[model samples]
Target: MKCISWNVNGIRAVLKKDFVEILYALDADIFCIQETKAQPDQIEVDCELYPYQYINSAQKKGYSGTMIFCKEEPLSIRYGMNMEEHDTEGRVITLEYPEYYVVTVYTPNSGDGLKRLDYRMEWDKAFSAYLKSLDKPVMACGDFNVANEEIDIKNPKTNHKNAGFTDEERNSFKENLLAYFVDTYRSLYPEKVEYSWWSYRFKAREKNAGWRIDYWLVSPELKDKIVDAKILTDIYGSDHCPVQLDIEV
Candidate 1:
């Protein structure tokens, strides 16, 4: 199966770009999008090709949101972890299939000056627990908001204390992986320098000054079925590019 994840930044905005064209070009079996920033009624997404569509939009208008579209209908779909604090942001969605569960998340970003770092830490712990409690093997994807390792960021030295690169955020990501998930991209290309996200400022994308913050993490057992995990940097509509995963499932 071909599964792809992209943080479109804003669904309505990307729709004005080549979002639909890219969707047709990729022709993925499943597509997960984050930072939609709109409710279903607010945007007209003509993804009739993908019969199954699930959306989790934040209560706040034009804020964080996510959605998943799959050609194959799932057995069940869940909007959030059933936790009040986290559900309000419309950050997570889980679809259960016969073989495995597909989850897409839009992790909260620690605000400027790391103002929300403490809350972000709490969120990490809760999110991990939620994933661990899943009944089946999982294929999780989206913008996790953390650059994980030094190699993930363009200038680790300068970004050490930043919201997404703080030591605390990185360690939380590590703990999540240690729990049972595998970073598919790193597993396939250990030393690859490709990135999924870039700053909109200072021509970061042109300079290739980006961070591999978006990911497709799967249960350790599914690692063997992963044929390819790649960052599709060439495609553009948002500041973030898409990440693709080819698996036997």
Candidate 2:
């Protein structure tokens, strides 16, 4: 199956762009989206291909949210980590199939001056535990927010202390998620440099100064089934481009 994940930044805004067209062109079996920034009632995706659509919207209007569009119906669907504090943001959505569970998350960013770093660390721990509790293997994807290694970001030296590239976040990501999951893109292309997210400031995209924050992480057991993993840098609509994972589940 071909699964694609993208942080659209804002669903309503991206809809005005070429979101529908791009969505059709990609033609993924399961398309996961993050940072929807809209309520369930406000999200109207005009695509007919995906009959089974699920959205997890935040309690607060126009904030962090996630959505999944699937061509095939899942056996079950779950929203959030089931933790009250973490569930409020609509950051996580899990779709359980016969073979495996697919989860998409919009991990909270450490705000200016790392104000939310403590909360982010707590979230990482809780979210990792949630994944471990799943009965089957998992294919988790979305804007993870943290750049795992120096090669994952363009200016690692300058960004080491920044939100996504901070030492604390990186170590937590490695210990929590990477301990059990395989980062498909990095696993396949260790030396190839590419990025999925670019800062809107300073013509970052134009200059190709970006970070590979978005990812498709699968359980270690599913690593061999990975056909291909790609960062669709050509696609435009959001600050973060879509990351694709073609795997046999």
Candidate 3:
């Protein structure tokens, strides 16, 4: 089955930009999105095929949030990491399918110049622990907000001091990938120079100056099942492209 993930940036905003058309084109078995920034009541998507709709929207308006639109119904669903503070921002939505679990996240951005770096580090710890606790194989996918390595970004040396490429942030992000499971994109095509998010500044998309901050992380148990992984770099909307994976059990 195909499991897809994207940071839509804003549900309300992307609709005008052909969000549904993109979703239909993907035609994934399960569709997950981050940075929706809106509640279900606040928006509407017309899709008869994928009847299951789940969302974890921030209590605050026009802020961080996530959602999963799936064709297959999950046996169970959960929101947040069981932490009150973390739930407020609506960052995580866990769907327990019969075969595997899917955790979609909109990991907090550390802000320019590492302004919110401390808070982001705390989130990393909490979020990583939450994923490990599941133990059940998971497809933890969405906007991770930190480019994993030098290959994941265009100009690594110049970006070292930047928010998404800083030593501290990169280390924090790197540690979790090591502890948890496999990074699907990096595993399947290690040599591919790809990116999932681009900056709005300086025609980053045009120059192809980007970061592989978004991901599709699979549990170690499912490592062998990952058939294909891709960053939909050619697709566009919200300055972030969709990352997709096809898994064969």
RMSD values, in order shown = 0.9, 0.6, 1.1
**Displacement of the residue 66 alpha carbon in candidate 1, Å:** 0.3
Q: TM-score: which is higher, 2 or 3?
A: 2
lDDT of 1 by residue, 119-150 (tens): 99999899899999998999999999999888
Q: Which 10 successive residues of model 1 have the least lDDT summed?
A: 171-180
Best by lDDT: 2
Model 3: residues with Cα > 4 Å off, grouped in runs? none
List clashing residue pairs in candidate 3: none
TM-score-sorted candidate list, best first: 2, 1, 3
lDDT of 2 by residue, 140-212 (tens): 9999999999999999999988999999999999999999999999999999999999999999999999999
Candidate 1: residue pairs that collide:
none
TM-score of each: 0.98, 0.99, 0.97
Clashes of each: 0, 0, 0
lDDT of 3 by residue, 1-249 (tens): 898999988999998899899888889988998988887798788877589989888999989889899987888999999998788999999999777899999888889768989998999999998998885788899888898889999999998888888888889987865567799988888889988888899999999998999889988889999999988888877899998999995
Q: Give stretches of model 2 more than 4 Å off.
A: none
What is the alpha-carbon lDDT for the whole of candidate 3? 0.88
Clashes of 3: 0
